[model samples]
Target: MTVHTGAPRWWRATTGIAVPCLVAAACGVMLWSSAAPVVDFVYFMLAGWALVLLGIAWLVLVVIGWFRYRTVRRTLLAPAVVAPAFVLVTAALVVVQAPFRLGFLVSKPALADAAADCTYSLEHRRIGVYSVRSTREFDGGCLFFTQGGLIDSVGIAYLPEGVPHLGAPRHDGDIGYDHIGGDWYRFVERF
Candidate 1:
């Protein structure tokens, strides 16, 4: 076994640390995109930018690592292993909609309580984990609306009777309601 002498920590990091970070950042971007409706859009965009910066940092490290350790190994000069793993994991996430499903599960209870408290109120309020901009009662459940962006909004509704446009992905040009599961449905409007 050939020992790598006079190698800087960053050189090792190209393979050891940077590759893993690159894969993680990619996964984060994917998961955040799926969960964006329930999360703060500002933070989501910021996270995307941060992930871009991380990818750039990893690329720079790999370039320097390759020049310095030209004779070391090809593995250090590329994201060979982690890249394929990222692809496979991303495919799985897309197939299952894991993040969106998880966001629904985690935010459901808090949103249910918020809906209960907003029956007669129209003012902005923070109830438990979710912020409610407005609320409306349906057949036997409630719809809680929250701002996802300046031109976009998302709602977490407990519609046991089912979403109005459950099967239709888009109600009109910019309005839509998509079912999550059970009594949970995602209400999205792009204004």
Candidate 2:
């Protein structure tokens, strides 16, 4: 019986470094996208767990590679480096997401207040009501009211400190006003 132990040089190099590098990049993108609001909540959650799992899998592959090919120690470095990179990337993602989550929490009260004020008025007398809706499409939080409502508007709020320039609420449509100076905005639909 013959036992095959050595892998081809190219195979070892590709698997050791190239594959791990690709995986790490993918994991980083997933984590980043998950945090940046490009992906939905379910995808974000899945990507987060996938990153962790990929890190673990890379570590395991490195260990297996280390044992399988005694001569290709250099190849094992890929996964070795990738495992920690994954962890760091995931940590960074969490750190980046923390503020957004905190901002959402902080802004909830303001949103509720705005919704209440917009929904009720002496003249309109509760013709309609503003309701809290998922802001996933807008990448933050929003309160929306329908037409003929006391106030038909979409209110968007961001982190008070780190307002994202890219996804900031549009001010060109309808009658827009700054609800909280710079961090919050409301766009009232034109009647």
Candidate 3:
């Protein structure tokens, strides 16, 4: 009777990298969506399902490798690390409010273009992290940016004169705004 120590080097390299990378990519998709959104909201759905399915697959593989082969597979080790690391990274992102800041950084170029042209209100325009469903409403108003969602939305706004930052985000009713810097703001429309 012989006991398998672990997967071969080739299997470890290929399968090891593929599964863990895919799971890590799923984590990345979630981070990006939260940090900087995209036009299609379906990506959130797809990414969520991918994490669930991949988790199940990983469990099955781990169980099989352990019970049948009586060996802990080296490929299975990466996810154990990735899952915990993802949680820590997520916490850090929230603490620093990375989403609000990242949104501005990612959309800076487009926001500048929008600022320069008060009349450039185009519907469904996409050039950065998120798509603008209606630059029209914000036209001649403030930052002239919008990432309108069917239910919720995000965009850059401008704080009126003397509406000082006070070092915190301000909220009103169903809408909330955060000061990105200077006179610029990032606003979110709640559903």
Candidate 4:
């Protein structure tokens, strides 16, 4: 009886790279999905089902591979090889430095063009020019909450061209304002 010593070189190269890439892509998708809920909301019917199918396929493959092979090392190495790449890619994506802030849209009128004249109002609070042709709204209003705010309300505006970094909030309940929480240079993107 012959025991397989290791995965074939081609298998290592292909699955090692491809599996991690797929998993990395999945991670990116998952991250973006969290930051942008529109996907789950709009594509939940089809994309959600597709995600379930992908998950099922993954489980089936795991079971088949486990039954076909006796060693855990062989069964797991293919996916493991890509783990570093996943971390590297994810980190690169998360840590990108930008001089300008990126705003994500959180609410309705999904079909509107990336507008320069958009406005947002919450109750009596008004946030005008919250977005522009240059400033993009991805997913939906994900960044609006962080962009501008009162203690209870948040606002954001996009300059059609570009503008100086607007001052942080000084007074309470001011539209297009927010109290500075940290270093303005390092703006963290949150969901």
Which has the greatest lDDT? 1
Candidate 1 deviant stretches above 4 angstroms: 1-5, 13-33, 36-42, 71-95, 113-118, 122-129, 138-140, 167-175
Instruction: Give RMSD to native, each candidate.
Output: 5.0, 13.5, 4.9, 11.0
Q: Candidate 2: how many backbone clashes?
A: 0
Question: Model 4, stretches more than 4 Å misplaced?
Answer: 1-17, 36-40, 43-51, 78-191
Write the number of the candidate with greater lDDT, choosing between 1 and 3.
1
What C-alpha root-mean-square deviation, in Å, does candidate 1 show against the real structure? 5.0
Task: Rate residue 89 of model 1 by lDDT.
Answer: 83
TM-score of predicted structure 1 = 0.64
CA lDDT scores, all candidates in order: 0.63, 0.47, 0.58, 0.37
Candidate order by TM-score, highest to lowest? 3, 1, 2, 4
Model 2: CA > 4 A from native? 1-14, 36-39, 75-80, 98-155, 158-182, 185-191
Ranking by lDDT: 1, 3, 2, 4
Best by TM-score: 3
- Judged by lDDT against the true structure, how good is candidate 1? 0.63
- Residues 66-153 of candidate 1: C-alpha lDDT, one tens digit per residue: 5665534655345434644665786587458777677667777777666565474577876443566777776587777765654567
Range of the 10 consecutive residues with the lowest summed lDDT in candidate 1: 166-175
* TM-score (C-alpha) between model 2 and the true structure: 0.41
Worst 10 residues of 2 by lDDT: 121-130
